[model samples]
Target: MCYFLGAMPLQCVSGIFVLYSLCLLSFSPHCDGGNILVYPVDGSHWINMKILLQELHTRGHNISVIRSSTSWYIPEESPLYTSITIEMDEDVEDFFDVFLQEHLRAQRDGTSLLTFFKLTKGFLSMIARAHLLWSDATNQILNNKTLVKSLKDSQYDLVLVDPAIAPGVVLAKHLKLPLVLNVRWITSGEGHFVLAPSPLSYIPVPGSGSTDNMSFFQRVKNMFFYSLVLFQEKFLVGPIYDAMCDKYIEGGCNIVSLLQEADIWLFRSDFVFDFPRPTMPNAVYIGGFQCKPAQPLPADLEDFVQSAGEHGVIIMSLGTLVNTLPKEVTEEIASVFAKMPQKVIWKHKGEQPSTLGNNTLIVDWMPQKDLLGHPQIKVFVAHGGTNGVQEAIYHGVPVLGIPLFFDQYDNLLRLQERGAAKIIHLADVNGDTFEEGIKEVLYKDSYRQNMHRLSRLHKDQPLAPMDKAVFWVEYVIRNKGAAQLRTGAYKMPWYSYHSLDVLLFLISSTTLIFFSIIVMVRYLCYRRRNTKPKQS
Candidate 1:
């Protein structure tokens, strides 16, 4: 006899029955399975999300990633997750390339004034590019009936969004899913403006590079930068976001409002890496969370490190965006490495300089974490990317930073302040200067000791960053949304948040009382003088 239970076949032989339980179990979803949709901004953003999402997948979640077609950091194919590619126009990609090239060129050749102008222009261009990209993505999602239907049908339990890019909020709102923010930078962007406390008096503005212990003038400067950021967000980026939402998002949501609805915020920084600041319960710091145990190096690479002997080794990488350096700069770097006693492994995509050093090995790519974790590494020569800096901290390696742009300067500055790193600007990077920087970091025991101290602090968290991220992610899914964790400040108006209304009322009342007393005293004096005027 044959029987079926929920599409499972059962067999009865000689009055004994056997059920095909394995088949049912194989078809069933993991006990903690939940559909998670991730919207990443760019290649760099994707790299950070990839780490957190991979962990989520390992813990029985179904993940789907949506990225631009022109994204450079595409993840390897995995049966456990799915990828959705969105098309970007060739012209748009070309504009970004040209813009970055011009900016780098300006930094390489121009004076400070010229560089400032070029950076301003570059920032404007970047804003335009972001607006265009978000607009295109919004239109694509709204216009494609099949894609829209498939997305709605997927029934995602939660959405992991890169708050740097505004379209993620639109997608989450469209799907009506609980939102989780993954901030890929050390500095808080719009997410902090909405959810986190940002007191300009102590907390330096993102690009200011100032520390918490600021002088009176420095605090004024910090306040200026904060105001500039607010102006840009409101007058510049606001219109673009509003237009995009007005076209696609029903009821036309504001970007800040959308972000404030987020259930959890994961920042890519820790107290060790970033200056101490007040954070809300919903905000979780997961700096170096992407770092993992070092795998054995490739045989050839292992042999190269081993060959260095007692002199140790240094790793030079400018992160992903800066794959190629100017030929002159490259030659200078190579020449500097040639004189160093330690072996150098540089990640360079440009043509090898004619003066390339014999002591230096240039590879197109490297497993940076693995190389940093190696016992042979003496110091890391980096562009001061957050990921690179955090990895260096995790491995307890001192850094020689040659910061290029954006948060790289601030990141390097923080490390420099922490006594773990030194920075050499790109314009100041010559053979002699580069060599001096490397020598200082390599010879300085203080740098190494400080790095080790920070590493201990970073590792001393109650829950590992990955586990904390995973737990919160699951918490959002289990609880629908963690509204209780949200700060009440988000709902307060700007006047109420800063107590400006109360201050203004007090000032107005005091002014009114003072004026009334002065007028009454003047009238009494005038009346007394007039009554006695006849006798005078």
Candidate 2:
């Protein structure tokens, strides 16, 4: 048995090494360079992290990881990762696997809602008692005497922090190593951009650029929606993330501060999925990092698709979250497909929608990328997920996006404006609208042409997103800190960046004063014009 004590990989016994040497005269590949430590939000992230780690190792860099026990609903019986094997404490490993198994099973059965709530409550509890929790178990993990001692012993060079589980940032700060943060979404900077209401009417959206063409009443409704989102963030999300990171992760252990103290920032987006990049210097859009189509579809499925012929095919999926929208919403979407001229292939996790007809093949799951690559795939109807959007662009497939929440709406709008997709409101969505949207996508040569152009533009780039991410990551390690790219804007308050309320106040005050002046001038003019008024 090999023993992993802290960070060192050691032989359990001298006699075992001797025995192994006697049995085989093979040597392990020589590992080199500074060690890298990774922290991600479990499951596929773990898998992706391991893949990167192995690639780094192949280039001769030593690596160690501190992954969370949570699996985020991926099945437990499945292997942790395909590329590398990890050695963890047996008890910890067992607990993690068992937790994943139970949670994943519940997720499959649609009973994970209560479990999710309970976990959310615990997270809230930890946040509420952050000071205590910080000084105790959670914070200790980051600055654990054992882990730090290991890193110091190994002389690890860089630390990668996943903003999702960012405790490692505190650890990085404590150790004073180069830090890198992996931003998953528009979570930072007050959460108002896409999540909040900013004169961005969300509910009764008529089309992609509806705001630009909206009536005054429509604008008012949009502003109302935007304001409600801001209220939610101000009261809820902002405080929660702060409480989680500030008190518990960093302050107690000095790990997160180290992470925030990191020299480089990596924003994962290829710009294919998002439009008009955020104005952060170190932030690079590395989305579509996993854009490659993994494998070909099964022969039987290929034949079925090929048999469909000139009618073409429509692929329908709501991505992972809201995979099961309300039955009404599903029926509306299905009815639209029923009336469509194309054959539809719907990737639904629930029971087959009753409205689906002979032309529609309602399956529990489909090879998303593979289906997109198919010549018969005419259009995509998706929930405007980052991954889905990227895939559609990669395969030159046009989309009908029905965004549900978060960045999905923004992504859909961006694609719609680019003429590669169309957006429909989740609330007022129906069969007629869906059918009309599909017809437009099919008849509109611009959407297909634009998607093809985008695909070419993406491919013509100097480097792949993954390559860029890896390069920048290495640059940080080689240069100690990528401070040249850091900007002064990071130091400013959130209110200053977006002067929305300030502008509103100025407009309101100016209108009030202008009206007052106009009223006074009119009264004076009337009195001056009539001598009888002056006498009165």
Candidate 3:
């Protein structure tokens, strides 16, 4: 009787398990016509988008991607993990290479940290034209009475716009669908420096005080330099960008304006890096969303690292854009590494340094994420790019950030502030500073503890970033743009947006004026009394 009772329930439990497994299996393949549109092009965007698309395909969600011709044209050397080979047309390749060459030139000139700021503005303006043209083209395609009639004729549940390629914003506006804006970095206000005037805060004067420190002659010269950029953005950037879109694609479409209306704004960095903004709910920090790296290291690199013994090896990478170090600086760094207690593995994409020290292993590329996960990697010398920063934290490795350009300073500073890393000034990146920063990161227990603390926080995320991104993408389809999470800050005035600062300034000014009037009144009374009389 007891055996028969147990067997009856066992069959029922098995039946339920089989049904659940079949349901999961039904949803797992990539198909062509999904009810989603992804845009604003980048490798990261493509990678994350592909994962979400794959999951959607498995789960039976339809997905379509709209990108610039050059969006997926990455060379084999860059670290991209995608199953599909992104084919690019010849004209697109030409346009992309030209843009890339110009972009590389801008990075090379951005050697000093402060100068990097100026160079970044020029670089952003350069890319902005390409993006504007691309976005215009995308919008034109979407607005084609035939295409629009057909798409509206059918159904696209939602629009997913990657901030990099950016045209997703335009299509979202045109389609009038709920928009999900995926920001891969510190975009938003920072990207505006390309199109708008730089505030007085961007002016580089030595003193910590106000802009009033400059001599009259120097201030005039600085103003001229500042105006040159402002004038260029006002007359050239906005108009030329407008003209390109107006002629080729959509008329009067602005990326920033589109972002203001996005149903959700997603950032790739952790919340610790993003400021506490009012739109915090719509702003989700989905950092380190990529598939986990396998524990095994590259056999060749692993063997080499193992041979180093107790000293361990240091891994250095300045990321893809600035992969090549100037020979002079490379030699100086090599000099320091040669004398150090550790072995060095530098990812040098250019020619190997002529100096060729015995302690260093210079390779064209290293699987950064995989290498960082390796047990043998002792310390990381990095450029403090967002991707690199997150990887370092995820692996609990200490970093020495040699920031070169574009939000790198801010990233490095944030990491340094968090006690996870040390910063090496670009101008001072000679042997002493580089060596000292490295030694500190390698030797310090506090640095390791701090990085571990962040790693724990990163791991403790409510849901993995990839899962969160995929869930949100599907949620947008089901609910038509997670509108419940959208804050009304988009409609607020700029002054009102920064109201606390405005209030502080007003109160300080009013207090100063009131005190001055009081002093003046007392002085006048004393003067009149003195003149009228000692006689009284």
Candidate 4:
């Protein structure tokens, strides 16, 4: 090395040193990058997971994504990560869209127990089918000696997976690699309830429609919602995963146990948007990790936004699940947007609404992050998914939420409570209500101001959410696993964790002592009365 440096010019040597330093700046603390094997859920979950992969790839980490052959959002080919395609029984994405449409239609008619039952049945069937396919795929992969040997040879540092599904958790365990969960939802409900201290009185269960502050009735409702989650897991989801584990893993396992075994949870939630709740040390918050500064818009879209001028533009998207609203709902929404002064860019995927206004531009897909970040954007008409809500907070854009299904109401309720958004329930979404909701958000300066405050709070963090996420992932990699940070709470049985057995024992002892004292006092009183009467 000294001989070569002597042969080289001093300027050339300095230039080489400078270039090497520049490369080091892009990497994490550890110089040599770690290999990350990812198993991501499809739809919006995949979108965020893809962002993480891009960042990791930039930092010189090797990434491999295990995806189902029938996945909709996760492409078979991507520069971000090499794909390990698992053969699926059928397409799972379409099931969600169909179920969403049916749910909307039921809500339009009127919400009743029958509607709830029907909608719930569809939702459960979707979950059951998706898990069945994924479990089968995982079983196939595990049983195939060639594929099993190949994955073993890869020697991944960690398995970063979205725990919304069971395959990744099981796969990570089967591979005996350190597990890191990129999660908001697990199989049944929000991930935190499973991993941290979640009090039913305060921590609102997803789909409960309860807030952090709860009334007696609301708390009761939250418990019921929480019970539903438990029921779904115990009956609907858990058995499938357990059956798969029994086939492949030693000493038959379950999904919850595997998830609990995860080393680090890169949770996609922030206290700024999410209610302040108890969180574990290993669970790192990365709420808006996927958000970035706005990019230049396409020429036509730019022209549309610029045409709005001072009125500014409104953008609406109902996440990836809802492709099209019911016909009546669509016409009502289109009519409402038509009457507004602001130009509207809607990510609609149905037949052209007859009532669509000239001011509204409909598209199949949108640059949601860029549009939210755009200065010309005024109001975000959203379905209140976590991604949209976080992006809205990141961009300081007030939301006019029309929550359709699945934690959407709970998501919007947070913003509504913060006075940054107005929620219009799916059943009540007509032209008049939609127009009034939009006008309220558009005219109210407080909505904008409140959101700006949230934006400031969310941005005031010491490290960017994405950087924090990458750091935790690398922390796990660098240290083999983060066992110290992970709490042993999950290992405790429900009775032990809640201290119910101790309570039962204490109660039993107290009752026994009280009764014994009463009996002894009665006996003493009787003896005293009898002896005194005889002496007299």
Candidate 5:
């Protein structure tokens, strides 16, 4: 009777087991949400981070985003995470505005060389402003006892930073969190040195636009550009970042050391879209992760596309930065579009061109990706921005690129090399050349075919880019920084990574052996001659 009283019903036993399993699941690290901090630099970088972070948030991770106030493309607030905005000083902000205006004017009015010079000056100004703003923000954050206390109390799991903004490194150090760098550009500048084996012999510099298949002279040119970039970053920009680190960090760290310690790097490119190159195990390519399926075009836009009938449509946009073209250039584009049988959608912010055609629709903004994905769209006229290029490739649409400044020229050059696009430089834009470029892309089946082939390869990944990125991010959390994936190359000196030490040793040994052989032969010949003469 005592044994029977102690026995439980089968259903009661099952319920107890289920409750115990649930408790264990709740306590497991993999099953729980992680705290993630995301900080993206200004410009198109915000778009890339938003896509990744939003997906992570949807998967139940806690997210916190901090961005500069000067960002032109401010993201909408999400209920899933906290948003922090850092404001720059009025003078710095004004300077940036003036610099942008001058830079754009240079792009429109000057030769490529002059444009490059102006842009270079503007870039230096931008670096200075970035330093000042970051310094001010860092001091503010450190001085605010409440903010500092909160950051310490929160205990973030990981900090995802943009390397373009150097101060983010110092902030990560202050928080004492593991770092994951999200680089939006294909080229990561000096950061590439520590991330992986980037041989300049094949890997072109950011603005050079040369491909991996370069001639002897081109390779030399590539090396020169590479050296110039490294010098600028190391001597010109490194001090600003170091100074910030010195002020805030207890031990103080430089940019090179900070990057070496990074746990993971997510590049906004893939081999299918970019040239094949060696990447570290920790480096992941999630190029088109931000791309989405085409949404239905607005009624007016749909109507405009349908009006063209069999000729299809063409979409032209110069991206967010170059909102307007020079009056003469605008007229050239307008005139070219007028001659085309297809309907044209041009995204322009400046005054309407005098040659504005009846077949063209000029708007301030267009859903670029959605339009690219449209079935009837035949060609994309673009400024060759990375995002735009990626979108055009994803949709298998051919491009007529009008590259202006920065990496635009390089980006178009790559596309042109791939037979997927043709480029007409902004400075060289005229009605005849612009018209020819448009016609060449439109009439040529090779351009469309190559783009389609690339699109297939891009989509053939084992996992979707977004899934791949999220899995790695989570993997880092689950594995506690995933140190095993890190390459020893980063820890090695530059000479060691390139086998320069081994090469130098081989060269020295060969020279010494050759010298010793020569000396021994001379001594034997001298002795033989002297002995023979004495005998005579």
Candidate 6:
């Protein structure tokens, strides 16, 4: 931007420029909302993203969303954002539904190393397919000259993307716009490993299911799990993005670097919910941003919860993805809930179980946050999704986690490490185990106390997490992206990033110097010996 608003003297330009920046800052806290182009991952990712959009809309930000035509969770029409739907051959939810059944069966089969490896393999397959679908969708957008031109013409200030899928990252780079990521998982793994210093010695990799303090073998397990993440990225998922970049994006980009190059990482993690770990300045923690003070529940639901009286209620939801468990497992859980004095509300969407309890209410959906914060609520039976876990922490409700798949166990472990949750392995899930877990979280005072302690810590933040997220998002728009916050390490190749090349050079130089000193000393000794013999 030029200092002069019009044709003016260069002498006055400097003073005007300084004043303009100060003026911009003075008024930028609230603007007619910056133009935000959102590329959101479907499914539960949309749930939290919708919250951000609602807030942005309230501030008068114009939002346009890129969605798949067959998106299961993202509806075609919404007042929050206009939709740009891309047609696709397949629905991701279709496979995910199939995968859920297989994944549950695989988990219930056993807990052996081989079984876990198989689970990893299955997960990689799903990730690879998902990436392919997103890449193809991105390619369609890039190839369409009209759409591409219009996207540019819209003059969006920045791209707000969930980096779990790299299509958005690739599209952001193609547009050459500032980027803000609503991210926890990227294409490879957790966002920290890509952008910050995550020494595996202490930081447990996702899917490893280890706590921050790990045993020797647990660390090895963590390392192995990390390798799987890398392998998935490099071999399984990376090539899809690479081909897209090669064809569509200028120059060439990889998903990992694109994620690292983002102007802001609105990380959905809090130190209270997560272990203490290194973070980047650009990585703003907006954990529990979706959480708020409980709103009034529906009259009928309130009546049900109030009927629990002193025993309080328990709520179970396995998220939108996992609609129902296998029949036998479902019956077992239903049976156990039937015997409990505390009432249970389960979010299930299928045939009612034969053993369903009189004291339980089954719903296709629930006001989960509202229920969690209710005074009559005592326990959360969760699948350990990050959103649910953070909400549980926000409401100070202890969890009985029956983690079904993908980072759920790890999320629960974070709570369990602090004694706020009890975990039961899926393979070990039965009536006895389910009942025992629920009882421990419900009856034990420590579980409630610890969770309450965590809730207090979470609530003690100076700025509401959502406000902090929005402020940084606006910060990117006002500054046109302050690249100074991002470190240059991500731009380096692995050899340079880790200093491996420097180490090799130093070793070779030291070896050469030592050899030369030895040779010089030997030559002097030989000359002295020869001269002494000649003199004699």
The numbered model that scores best in lDDT is: 6
CA lDDT, candidate 6, residue 198: 93
Sorting all predicted structures by TM-score, with the top scorer first, yields 6, 4, 1, 5, 3, 2
Provide the global lDDT of candidate 3 against the true structure: 0.64
Question: Which stretches in model 1 have alpha-carbon errors above 4 Å?
Answer: 1-31, 75-77, 91-93, 185-190, 504-536
TM-score attained by model 2: 0.64
Candidate 6 lDDT over residue span 129-243, tens digit each:
9889888877889999999999999999999999999798889899999999999989988989988899999999988888888999999999998888789889998899889
Q: Please give, for residues 243-346, the per-residue lDDT of candidate 4 as tens digits.
A: 87897788878888888889999989898898999888888899999888889999988898999999999999988878777888899999989988999999
Candidate 6 regions exceeding 4 Å error are 1-30, 532-536
TM-score, candidate number 5:
0.86
What is the TM-score of each predicted model, taking all chains together?
Answer: 0.86, 0.64, 0.70, 0.89, 0.86, 0.92
Off by over 4 Å in 4: 1-28, 501-536
lDDT of 2 by residue, 1-536 (tens): 33553544554466667888976755532223656766554533454455455556666666665533333433333233221112222223334444433433433344354855553344333333422322233454643567557667777678876654444555566667788766553222221143223334333322123424457787775565455444433554445445545654445422222333557666656655554324455666566665675467899777777777888888888764444666776787787777766777887776667887787787777888889988888889888876788888888899888775445676787778778888876645667777778789889899999888888877677778777777777778778877777654444456765777688899999999999999999999898888564444
Candidate 5 regions exceeding 4 Å error are: 1-31, 69-71, 75-77, 91-97, 107-115, 185-191, 495-536
Off by over 4 Å in 2: 1-34, 42-63, 73-137, 151-154, 184-260, 271-273, 277-281, 339-341, 488-536
Q: Candidate 1: minimum summed lDDT over ten consecutive residues — where?
A: 10-19
Of 4 and 5, the candidate ranking higher by lDDT: 4
Q: Residue by residue across 84-166, what tens digits does model 1's lDDT show?
A: 87776643556766776776777788558667766866876676567656667666876798998999899899999887776
lDDT string for model 3 (1-536, tens) is 33454566777778777998998888753333347655545543455555555665676655555544445433233222212122333334455445555544554455565654555555556555555566456546654678667656657777776765555555666668888766753122333232223344433221111132356665665565556545544554445445433543445544455565677766676655533322346666677766476467778878888888998889999876566765667877888888887888998876666666798998887888887887778889998777788888888888888776555666776668778889876657677877788888989889988988888878986688877776676666666677667556555667786697789899999999999999999999999988985655
Better of 1 and 6 by lDDT: 6
lDDT (CA) per prediction: 0.81, 0.61, 0.64, 0.89, 0.79, 0.91
Residue 352 of candidate 3: its Cα lDDT? 69
Spell out the clash pairs found in candidate 4: none
Give a tens-digit lDDT track for model 5, residues 354-403.
99889999999999989999999999999888899988888899999988
